[model samples]
Target: MDEDSDAQVMLRVAAGDRKAFALLFDRYHASVARFAYRFVGDRARAEELTQDIFVKLYRNAKAYKPTAQFKTFLFRVATNHCLNEVRRGEYRVTRSTSSPADEDEKGVEAVDAQAERPDEAVAGRELERAVGEALQGMSERERAAFTMCRFEGMAYRDIATALEASEAAVKSLIHRATLAVARKVEALQAGIGPERSRA
Candidate 1:
């Protein structure tokens, strides 16, 4: 079935179909977990949050409206849960100190080192770290907007719906976030340049 058929499955779930719910869970669990990990930066906590989101989805199945795309509804639920966790100070973006097991289990894409020299690979990892730090420094709304647009490839209108903000506001947040991250990355590159340049 087409992936957009998620709505049909959701309708079935709303009508009390456990098999449909299971299919939906199997389809979206990994994606939701990855998005949560990107937002929270902790594999274990992201897994917990992913479980909570699915539980919410199951409990609120009757509220699913076909008016919007099912993906939008799923992300809206996820965004609210993540923001609440942040507000409660239960979420932390601390990938640097995460345990080896957490890193191994994390679903975020790693810096690709294939066919690259050692120096280039090192630079790639450094750049990835810098970008991650830049994202963490953004305001919650800005980070959410930037991540949805840039990483998740979501349209501004859909993101606005998920965030419950105006499209213009989402655009502004993403614009500022992009500039901030770019500036930080440039600074990181400069800092990592030759020692003679720093002298």
Candidate 2:
């Protein structure tokens, strides 16, 4: 749906229109789940978190202002929920493996397993693990901003609104997080090739 239509639907949702609410859920569920998965790096927990986030959104629908774009507003809810979940220490962030089928179910584009060389696939997994580990080491705000900007492809302005931070602050957070993740991935790549020790 277009932005204005989304806002109108949300207005209907705020008025206790169940169908409108369902429509919003259908439209955003996958993206919300993917954001959660990227945030926590756990598919099962991400699923749980997505459900919780939607429940919270339903309860708080009255708080939504039509002035904000629905996508940003939805992500504001999602970003805050994710930060709260992590801050509560509900789970430790870890690299949870997902099969290609599983990622596909979540609307993630999984690499073609048949097309990739086995060694390249292994390297890709290692890089994912490295990036996940780097994310795990980040502060809550940094991680949230980073995931929104990188994984979700959100603009900095939208991310700033979702994060309730200044655009400059969001920029700083993403920059640091990106640099850290890049360093980890680079180190992992360096270790994978010429640096490997021979038995």
Candidate 3:
């Protein structure tokens, strides 16, 4: 079925349809988990968060409104949960440590940094680390906007709906986030070049 059909299933779920809820979960579980992983940067925690999100959805299904798309509502719930976790310091500890080499990192590679040689591969990894650090430094809203826009390829209007912000505000958040990440990456690369020159 087409994605828009998920909203119909959600409406059925609102009316106490167990099968509909299962269908909804099956349709979105992976996407939600991936989004949570991007926000939290921990696979286990992301899985937990995804489970929590689905549980919340089940409980709140009666409140579902078709005023917007179902995906928008789902992301809105996910974003709020992630931001709360961030505020509660659940993710802060992980953010302090460097991201380990993981399969999940492949999903967050919004930039296509082709590295043909061994040195370039090392540089690519360093650049990815620097970008991850910069992301950790972003404010919750900025990070959310950047993730949705860059990693998820969400449109600004959809992001604004999920974030409850104006489209202009979302644009500004993403632009500022991009500039901040770029500056941090350049600084990191500058430091790396000097060390390499000395070697």
Candidate 4:
């Protein structure tokens, strides 16, 4: 459904409509799970976190105002929960050791479908690993912004709202994070370690 429709469903959820809540949950569950997975880097923990996020959304539905896109509101909730959990040391974020085929099965991250050649597939895997390493090294805010912007395809303004930061600040976070990831990926491609690449 479109954002307007999602907003209307959320309003119904706020008014105690069970079906509406279910519908919203069905619509966004996978994406939220993917977001959580990216944050925690573990499928099982990400699933648990996704469930908690939805429960929190249901409980706080009354506080939701349709001032922005429904996604912005939803992700704001997700972002806060993830950052809080990380800050509290509830779970440490680590790179997933799952192979490309495993990630494809779980829909966590997709290997390029066009990468049929062995070398192309290897390059894709290297790039994915480098990006994951870069994300693990980032500050929470930078990681959040970069994931939303690059992976979730969120716009800068939407990310700013979700992050409760100014657009300029979101842009800055994304820039630094993206640059780091890019450098790491480039280093991998150049047959160098990221630290040496930085040097």
Measured by lDDT, the strongest candidate is 4
Best by TM-score: 4
Instruction: Tell me how far the alpha carbon of residue 140 in candidate 2 is from the true structure, in angstroms, after superposition.
Output: 1.4
In order, the Cα lDDT scores of the candidates are 0.77, 0.77, 0.78, 0.81
* Order of candidate numbers by TM-score, starting with the best: 4, 1, 2, 3
Tens-digit lDDT track of model 4 for 121-149: 66666666666778778888998898888
lDDT of 2 by residue, 64-93 (tens): 999988888899999998888877876766
Query: lDDT by residue for model 1 over 55-108, one digit each (tens)?
Result: 899898899998777877888898999889888886777657765345434422
Q: Candidate 2 has which clashing residue pairs, if any?
A: none
Q: Over 4 Å off in model 4, which ranges?
A: 105-113, 193-199
TM-score for each of the candidates = 0.83, 0.80, 0.78, 0.87
CA lDDT of 106 in candidate 2?
A: 42
lDDT-based ranking, best first?
A: 4, 3, 2, 1
Model 3 alpha-carbon miss at residue 86, Å: 1.8
